[model samples]
Target: MGIPLLENRTSPAGARPAERARRRRYALLAAGTAAMLFAVGGRWDVPLAAWLFPVLLLRFTRTTGPWAGTLWIWAAHIAAAAFWVYESALGSGPVVLAGAAALSAVQAVPFLLDRLLSARLGRWTAPLVFPAAVAATEFLITLLSPFGTAYGSLAVTQHGDLPLLQVTSVTGCYGIGFLIAWSAAAVNGFWQEPSRPSARPAAACAAVLAAVALAGGARLALLPHDGRTVRIAGVSPARTVAAAGRAALARIPGGRQGIAAAPPAAVDPATTAAQDDLLAATRREATAGARIVVWPENAVPAQAAREPAVIAAARAEARRSRVYLDIGIAVYDTTGPAFGRDETVLLGPDGAVLWTYQKAHPIPGSETYKPGDGRVPVVATPYGRIANVICYDADFPAMMRVRADIMLVPSHDWREYGRPHTDKAGLRAVEGGYALVRQDADGVSAAFDGRGRVLATADSFGADRQTLVADVPVRGATTPYDRIGDLFAWLCLATVPLLAALATARSRRR
Candidate 1:
């Protein structure tokens, strides 16, 4: 009796310490996962971190109880979202906070699904669940959400890895994300079992990833680049000139609210100076052997009554220089809707209006313009087939699928969103097999070839004259993604249901 009592007391005591140790280890893992999430996306991102964080997260979730694991993962996502809002130009208002919280909750669904389903199925099939869930979630968000592919895209982190990024031509952005998530799940399987047999899944996944990289490399090396090239120039008004225009506008009575009451004469002087600067820059670029000249978004600001005159002047400039000119203008209406118009007008070398495209997607909460019809316009030019979209419009992959050689993106960006935004846009070049030229005001302007090679770049903040000139390819390649659309993403989405059903059937059998 005495021996039995002693054994019971000691066993309970020992178990308490073990339980505490387990909880401590889980807490550490949770912390590490949160840190990785913070460092994986948004402004401060490491490509390797994107691949590693999911592994840690999968391991942590699998080891803990379902409810507890979900809570911790959600907490980690919240922390990451908070960090992103802090680091990005997005403000920290209640709406933004609520949005972040909702997004965090939605993001945690993949981890929850992985934790619940990965263990219930066969080891081989288990790894498929998490990646499919992740890819499906991302695809749904991009297809359904107004934000498009602006957030939570794992592909954006791997922008610097051109060879690895080539898979996007067939899979869109979702394929890279699926590969990363699958790698994470496959790696976690080895960590959980740690046997020679357990290593097979991870080894196979490694082989698959290697094959993808090799194929992408082969595509890049073998692609023909002997097509004709066109010299294109992008220009933005000098900071002083843009600032002077803004200052002049600020001096008007009632400021923005008084635009309706203010006469057209009151606004002309402020806008005229900036317009003159851009036209002069366009002329200089054309003289320097550029066949195409583009201005940044909203480069010319005019009252509604004065817009025709502005277009006429741009037309004259294009004819005089014998160059194709693309002009961005913001037309303020005094009598109509409170919102203004954001549009781009392209002029041929013969001074004919080629196309007038309004911005299809305006930055939410920033630009008040009514959205344009989502149709992308393509024009056949002597240089090549050309198409254009405004800045935020380029973020949507589906919207960018135009059969054109060169995609001109006239953009306006803040200092914080400059380079990363441009890098994200470059992925469109890879997916659509078109050269991209982005002219940005108050940001970084760059040109990229279809293979995601940077041709030229200029930073508005760093340069006295914010201009870029590049020899862009005059022919476009046809990609599987451009032809098949989001079939890969849809397949990933379809696999999720099939996987879930299989897991359910297996659990019932057991």
Candidate 2:
């Protein structure tokens, strides 16, 4: 009796050791997820990383329970995509940490659903279901995000791959994301059951890839490049003084309108200096045979409409150099406490104002200006139909809906966020099938064609005064995305609930 009792006690201890081993396995799995996500973030600059990211992630999370898998998915996204959030935190504080964690949670919902659906569905359905869930979530984010930004999307990673990126013309970025996610899921399915893996998923994935390649290849080959090319130059000033700062007397290299006196009471002297700098830069570009000269966002401290001197200087420059000018300025009215419109004005070669449009989207928290009533205007120019949008406005695809040959973006970015900010906005060109010319004060200024190809770029951090000159193709090709809009996204959204129901029924059956 005593020997039997001792053996029973030893068995309980042995079970405890097994529990410890199980806990260790979970920890290792979480660590692996973090590593995979870190690699995925490199997709922003490294195109190949996009295809390679989901292999480990889908494989590791497939075996876990829904709740645990959700947590792991959150961890993975935080590891990969939280660099921007962390950078947004000016200092290391508890608030920043909590904010970052909250952002990660919000972003993880789609990936969590991907894992959960894959677990519930049979191997045959996992590949299709998983990508649908991700597409649905991304579509919702575009609808709900403050500025309608799809910034961290995996599709943007393929911006460098012109053949692949042309897919955006049909289904927008969501289509590209679906293909990548599907491939990852298929790869995961193969790894899940190596010896008895089903051939159906692999064959299906290959068909989709082949179809996309063929379609994109044909489009690139057949698309007409018959439109006239416009010689555009972007003028980016290295430093800008705040509205409150004392005006410094700086001589513009080519223009006579050097820094002038400040307006009485309302205007700051710094406004005069900023205008002087923009006019000066314009002169230099115009001298270099640039027919259109663009200035960065907030190049003029005050609104050009309200301030005569600001418009006067720009008009003089435009007339003197025989070039078109697109200038960004802030408009103010004495209505509310924070009343202003971030606006862009287009001046023709004759120095007459041709068209003006307010920015549709204003960046939240960072910008205090009230959002502009949604308006997209296309101006007829000798070069082509031109559309104007401010920095944050370019983030929203819907805001970019217009028939235009070229889109002008007057942008401003902090030093740390230059490349990512500029590169991400380039996707809009692919979606809308328009060439993009962006001027940034403290970021990477770039010109991207309708195919999402970077023609020329200038790094502001690399020089005090940076300029980009490129002959951008006029918008000749109308994309299916512009015609049909978010049809694929809506389809995924309607399918997600059905997928969830199927998953739930499958879970119960098991």
Candidate 3:
């Protein structure tokens, strides 16, 4: 009887206007959300847009049909989120497009699932389902592609909001993500209904967010007493090498004539110049009263383990300068086919080897070296408990979840992705509650405090070599994120299936 009445009530022709209007609304909302995401991304990083995009997307999803929501979300994410990777993979146009499409499709899946589940569970549950499903998806994506970790996630959009960003230290970005998504969903539900049913969820979400903000404020206020300042210097070698090459070519017989007169010096000669430049920068920084001097990834020309002179020269420089020196070099395996591992060695002020760490998480395609098998080490230093990781290791949270006051990262970034890459690495410092000193060979050499505030930055692409010096605070406040490590993400993962099942049963009963 009910089925026959429902069938008689609705006709395709009668519903066309409403359906078309809904579709138009969905399209507008999708476009607006896409624009917001693009604007508030790594380039601009506006926090308000982070909240607005999710709210609009949630409204669109709630109102639109499942298939339409999925298609719209895929299109929007492809244009906004996935396209960011194109800069890193510009060489293969077709491959880049295909990857973007694939990533968009994957990103769309969670939103689609959330819409379907919310339709069954009712709008009240939307707030809970959206964050859980999306977080689970993010965690799964990270498992498949390590780069998928909340490196450039929407949480980063709030980088300028220190109190808001403090949530990362407790929940590893997912906590903030959950709050953002939940607030959006709750607001959408209230705005759509405008009744008592929606009021409860909206108020609940507001209360929870207020609590989070208060806790963040309290954490900031009650932070551990400011520790001693460590004067650190980060040197970029690319500009230095370029400067030296120009000087060398100028001394040649027909230097002003043409490119033909310049020897094939872009390779070995540039490497030699970079090594010399790094050593010079170390000496200069040491003399300038820097307690710690850091070099960019692969600062040495060849394998340091193979050549005793290379290590001897660095040791001599450390001794002469009387500063703690950290240098990144390739360490070759003695037993095999000279397969090298990327490594960073820390030299104490007395020229003694303090700590050595191999790059644990190497870039997949570019790095042809074995990953480090050792544990993440936090060595004690006069400044504080200092830890070191080389280049790609900074991307993985697990590789950096050590108890350290300061983290020294020797990074090498591609020209296009320098700033965002450096910023993402700084997010690690935020999560682990430590100061970061990141020296990049061909990128932005930056220093960030525990609050993820950029203390100093230097451009490695400029004509003149620049070294960044900053007095960075050490020994940050203790964070639950460092202690438990992705617990909030794991809880989200565990809740998704249960929520789906409950929603299905509730819908069946209805």
Candidate 4:
């Protein structure tokens, strides 16, 4: 026998009111759960919540009329987005709210698609619709949106779960998202139709997840860490020095604008003390046996004219200390149309300039630097094949797919985004099978092995000095994702239309 229909016209007219009331309760619960768990930074961000909210929301939509379901889901999404904005560093301005609303509208499309298409298909094929829609939406957002994969990715919520995260090594983060969405769809199917055959899909999803976890665990356990390791150190200015520099800059005549428009002579003095501190820290770390040293993003701020001198000082330091130095600097240009340049200049032991990489994806509204050509720079060193991408560039998986042993990310973040942002960057290490060293100014800095295991961490906010040292593997592991590159997301995107057309054709036959 088919499952008992709830609240539809097929039900007795007298029972309709109670059924609708029950479904409304489900909708409310779904909305509340989504609001609690949707955002990146929040107290209620439980991983299980990511798997659960979708199920309840799907059930509510499946039982309701198309228009009612669409409206309710949109409202739920809007509430979730607003909650996220409130928790985030992004201020809740009218423009941000409008953008969030627009994004919420897009986010609700998967639910609408599931509501419209699932009933038309057979039980075996029905559960695929929601996941396909969700994955497609996420993939499109990552591909086309300027925000990149910084927001709306369910995989980010599950960053703490390493075993499940290994799926990203093959399918990118989109695979993990797909599995989560598929689990929701599968569970809902089993909930609606409590028959033996209907249970197979849910069981299959569980099996797949279990298999993924087992395989991931095996990979993590079996991966040889006995290989050669290199000592690397990440450095940022002392809290006191950083504060003093900011104070000095704040005294400029035009306030924030003055720092950018001020003459090189005026800006140089303000930042000189902090830059000296960072260079000194690098020398100290190098003395302590760190062959490669890194400075946090914009650890040195200089005017365009003074930047050459800044580089010359860093080069002299690296040459004297006989260490490789990755120097992060912000070069302000008073005459140029662009505000400044945010970049990392790599210097070899011989004081030779290796490669200079500019930040490719600057944070949407906050950063005004001219972006780089989106190419990751990799060079072979004695330690390993090293690659560098500054800060927000790590968020884009497509750009981060370089075949390098070590990925150096120089970042700067506020207190609210520090740990979560670093954890998100670590996922790229797992995906690319490379050791990742993220050195952050005024935030949490971290280093992770290729298997996503933490090597070391330093919180600039908590510590007096932001200096982190870690021994990371010299050789990078090979992963399927690095070669195939988003094939699973592409497949998910391709399946949505085919499933919809099949469902449409099948509905006509009935």
Model 3: how far residue 202 lies from native, Å: 1.6
Cα lDDT over the full model 4: 0.84
Tens-digit lDDT track for model 1 on 18-70?
Answer: 67667665875665576566454466877888888888888888878887888
- Evaluated at residue 387, the lDDT of candidate 3 is 86
Q: What would the per-residue lDDT of candidate 3 be over residues 418-465, giving only the tens digit for each residue?
A: 776787778787898899989887778889888787889987776477
The residue-by-residue lDDT of candidate 2 on 1-510, one tens digit each, is 897677567753465665665665576566555444433323224566567666555655676666787787787676655654544333445554564465567656656777667667776776777677667666666677663553446676666677887888888888887888788888777776765456678778989899888888887788756757978999865454432322432322211112122233435455666777778878988888899999888766563344667787889889999998998876554444345657778888889998776766766545656666777767887777888888878777766766788989999777766666777788888888889999987788999988787989998878667888999996546888999999988897787778788889998988
Residue 433, candidate 2: C-alpha displacement in angstroms? 1.0
Worst 10 residues of 4 by lDDT: 35-44
For candidate 4, lDDT tens digit of each residue in 351-464?
Answer: 999998899998766676788999899989999899999989988889999999999999998787777788889989999999999999878999999988899999998888
| Model 3 worst lDDT run, 10 consecutive residues | 254-263
lDDT of 1 at 178: 95
Pairs with steric clashes in candidate 4: none
Q: Rank order by TM-score, top first? A: 1, 4, 3, 2
Off by more than 4 A, model 4: 1-44, 253-257, 335-337
Question: Comparing candidate 2 with candidate 4, which one achieves the higher lDDT?
Answer: 4
Tell me each candidate's TM-score: 0.94, 0.84, 0.84, 0.93
Indicate whether candidate 2 or candidate 4 has the larger TM-score: 4
Using alpha carbons, what is the TM-score of model 4? Answer: 0.93
